[model samples]
Target: MDATPVAPPTRAADARLDRIPVVTRSHRIWVALLGIFFTFDLVDLNTFAYVAPALRSEWGLSITAVGAVTSVSFLGMFLGGLLGGRLADRFGRRPTILGSAVFYSTFSLLSAVSVNVEMLAVTRVLTGFGLQAMTGVLLVYVTEMFPREQRGRYQSLTLALGLLGVPIAAAVSRLLVPIGPGTWRWVFVIGAGGIVGVILSVRLLPESIRWQVAQGRAEEAEPVLAKLESEARGILGRDLPEPGPAVETAESGNIRELLRPPYLQRLTVASAVMICLILGFYGFSSWIPTLLVEDGYTQTESLNYSLVLAIGAVPGALLAWPLVDRFERKTLILGISLVVTVLLLAFGISSGAVLVMVIGFLINMLMQMLVAVLYTYLPEVFPTRLRGLGAGCANSVGRLSGAAGAFIVGGVYSGLGYTAVFLYLALVILLLGTLLALFGERTTRRRLEDVGSAPEPA
Candidate 1:
């Protein structure tokens, strides 16, 4: 009789053999560190908004000029997300992250030294290139680090913590704006500090084991997985299941994959949501202090009201953590969109400071929450093979839309009035909500694989 042929070792079995359970403690620590990094990133990105009035006064900037300064960053961000996503896939998440961090930090420091509006615009563009890379890479990292069950909650929490920078920037800007003759420059200087710290801390972080395995670098991934497993067991008081074998289905780093069929749809929905959200957010927020100033409040009072509005975002971020995983992603998005639309209209129509503040608080809460949800939901819709690319494309599209929105709002607010501009924003938000309800997929409590695969029949 002929000798029986042996079958090849299965990928799943091979993965099981190489599996290492990660420690919860280490995971939590890493998550906390990432959150800190995000805070600085937010501060760096948003400080320009808070300091806009000061910059305008000193530079004699027109509405269009101010809009150009703000929108230029988004232009860079648009390209960065597209390029960085592909780079992360090809080069690995760690290198792309490190590179972007260094780039942003260096440019942000240089921004403080800007001598003219032209130089400032250039620096802002460079800073945005780096800043945008962080978002896609960070989302990929978070998804791979946590297990499927807790992915939504953990992502939501991290996002919420990161958003703390919004209020922090607002508060710090208020403090610094009043102190020195050139206080706005100090805000940029302080923002640069956060990026530097992140760059240093990231050195101690490990590369993603999933990415390693996917690249068929099992030998290299072993030690990292072992460390993770040991740490997880220590925290959970039990050994966790080892990750499955490295299945290299397709190259993850290629940007072209995003243009393919199902992925194209996912990209479209995500980009649309981003455009709507940012338009609503920046349209109202960029002019918050100006609005207050127009309503007869002193500069001090305007800044104070803006501070109050910023503070309200903290609880909003916190509240979003649990709900993100519990409800359908699209539903949460739609609900927030509706709430914000109504609140924006209310805010525009009202004259009383107290009433405006109340509406502003509600609007801020919903906007912050929507951001967290969008970040968490968008990535979940793409497979690991193209997670970075999908995220990058969506983010890039959103940034482009945001840039347009900024320009449009600046022109409209300058030419028309605040009420008309806000009413227009309300209509945009309502339209976006409708689109989400009609086209957005439900992703709550589902595994990333489930969402990332081809869509099911209607």
Candidate 2:
């Protein structure tokens, strides 16, 4: 009898998929779709910031009460991030993303119809739950799908696109919030349209091939791998290059493994960076108009300033694309964080409107740069099985800290001053930069397969 034919190794699918070059038509299309998905998340993410001042004026809320409205959403985000990550790892990235889209979209419209502060806060908390979990899953999907060499660049593109929502939210609020009483409700009404994109994403987005291979579903992974190979061949117009040697990796789908060796350090570092960044980001960025209003700027002037500040965020994100592959992500994050610290300090001391706007613009720009870099950096540290869980857990820390920071800033601003709040933000940012520079591992131009599976020190 003839000898039994042997099956090709399963990891060949992974090897084949990884060898595809970046910047293909197919690749660009994928980025665009993911970018649209992220755009909605950001719109909902930032909706409250623009509307909070209006809400405060309408409800006759105290500063702490306004901050509480903001903080409640983050409280929901904390749970959402943790739960979303676990679900993505357990079920699939695509489904979690779809469900999150539906959940947030429905509740966002409900917020518009809310009759009182308490009702609006409840809707926002539910909205936050879906919004953040969707964001966590989006990062995981992007990290897995993009080419290793250009992962940072592509992720930055999505970030730039997502940051556009900030400006969009600002523009909407500037136009609508000043019209008359109850106009703030229109902000959420326009934002509810983001749900439409979800239907499109469910149809267009591909399931992650790396995820399939990691789950030991080689048979399922092969067909997806073949499609990717075909796309690469079309782009190259020739035979593909040989894939690198495959390293053996454990199929760990457990959250417990995240607390063990090879993952614990990543968890710690990502969580630290996330916590500080979110505190500084939301503590300042989301609260910009409110802070300005307290500092004596009119609502219209504050909204205009915020709109200009929001415009800077797009470039801030775009600037990272060219440098992301060239410089190590850790170094870039550190540098941007330091710039943010100085700008925050400068912003605290400045007096003139032009000066404040200029300083605020610069600060927001640098903040977005930090955002692009960290979003790219954090997801690179964990394995496919734990990528969602690890990122989710880290994101939870940031959300919770951000919630606390919002409250602290409100209390401090009400008692101490804007100067005190800026000082606190600057200090937090400085420590975050220092910690990342000292302890974070380099992930420049590294393949996801190698970066994800490589052994770490105990």
Candidate 3:
């Protein structure tokens, strides 16, 4: 038999993947498809808040019970983030995304059929698990998709499209929940339609080529790379640039590695940021409608107010898209967090409806900006080998904290009211923002391979 000549390793795959221009037809399609999935995910996530007042009225549930229901969902999301990240690393991002969509959509359908609060809570938790884990995976995929130079811009655009679903959900709830008895079930029923995401993900999204190269699955990565290269060459009307040096990467990702050295610091800072951000987020966003209802505003009035507030999310995400790449991620995050604190405080203290609407609009805008910037920035700090795991674990911490914060808000609101909740959130945002400002890794405009290849901290 003739001797077979060995081909040199194609370890430069990450560099090649990174070298593609950020603007291409395929990239736009990916953004649109993923943005659609994210839109549905946000709709499902915000469903609980919209349904809560209805549940309280229909089930005669206490404030604590409503909080518990929300908490259970967060608990599920926490577990999902942990498991989903590991699974994505082991299996693939495409499959994980598909699985999460189906899992959450199925549970959301079941939640609609629940006969009582207990059943609803359990179903919502299951739905939340899939929804949240999917979110973590989605962020990982998105980070790996675009070149670092435009990652923020595209991610922000995707988020803007997705956040529009919040207003959609709020509007839907405004229309549906007020219709008749037991109409709240329709909110969840609508969320169950996220099954469409599974179909789109399977048919449209490709596996992360960067992930394939990092895993040393060069054979599997070839076709994906070819398609990307072809697209890039066609757009440039010439040959592709030679890729930079291959990144040195771990053979595989594991949680233990994340606990040590460079990753450990990123994990610590990311977790703190995630926790405080979610606490502040849920404190205001998730609790606002309930707080309004509790304060004697009618359910319709509360949802109407929330709907108006939700409208600002789209514009907020849009505002962040351009600036996301213009400024350092941490600097933008810190500045936005400070603005959010001021607006949150303003919203809490002001009693005039006109003032409230203005402040609420500003707050929602800043919150969406915060969300877009963080999503763009967090996954960049981890190596492709451990990106999913690191992002998942850190995000799960936020979910866990959110689970607890839900109950705390319930108790605090029941005792001290919205002002206290808003003030506490302000303090939390300040501390966490400062921590991130001090410790965050700078990844703006750097190659993923370069950013992820640095040595451990001393």
lDDT of 3 by residue, 1-458 (tens): 21222223454777777678747777888888888888889999999999888888888989889889989999999999999999999888989988899999999989989999899889989999999889998889889978778889898998888887899889999999999788888888878766876777677788988788777786687766667677767777766666777774538888898999889999999999999989988888899999887777888889989999999999898888878899889988999988888887877788866787788878988888888999998898899889999999999999999989998888777689778888888888887678888999887887876677695234
Query: Which of the predicted structures, 2 or 3, would earn the higher lDDT when compared with the native?
Result: 3
Query: What digit string (tens of lDDT, one per residue) describes model 2 on residues 1-458?
Result: 21322224454566766777745666777788778777777878888899888888888887777788889999999999999999988888888988888898899999999999899899999999998888998888888887888888888899898888889889999999999889999899866766776778777776777777777766776655666666667667676777776543537568778888778888998898899998898888888899999889999999999999888888989989898889988998888888899999999989998998899888888888888888988888888888899999999989988789888888778788989889988999998899999989778887776676685334
Which sections of candidate 2 miss by over 4 Å? 1-11, 248-250, 456-458
> TM-score of model 3 relative to the true fold?
0.96
Per-residue lDDT value at 112 in model 1? 85
Instruction: Answer with 1 or 2, whichever has the higher lDDT.
Output: 2
Ranking of candidates on lDDT, top first: 3, 2, 1
- Stretches of candidate 3 above 4 Å error? 1-11, 455-458
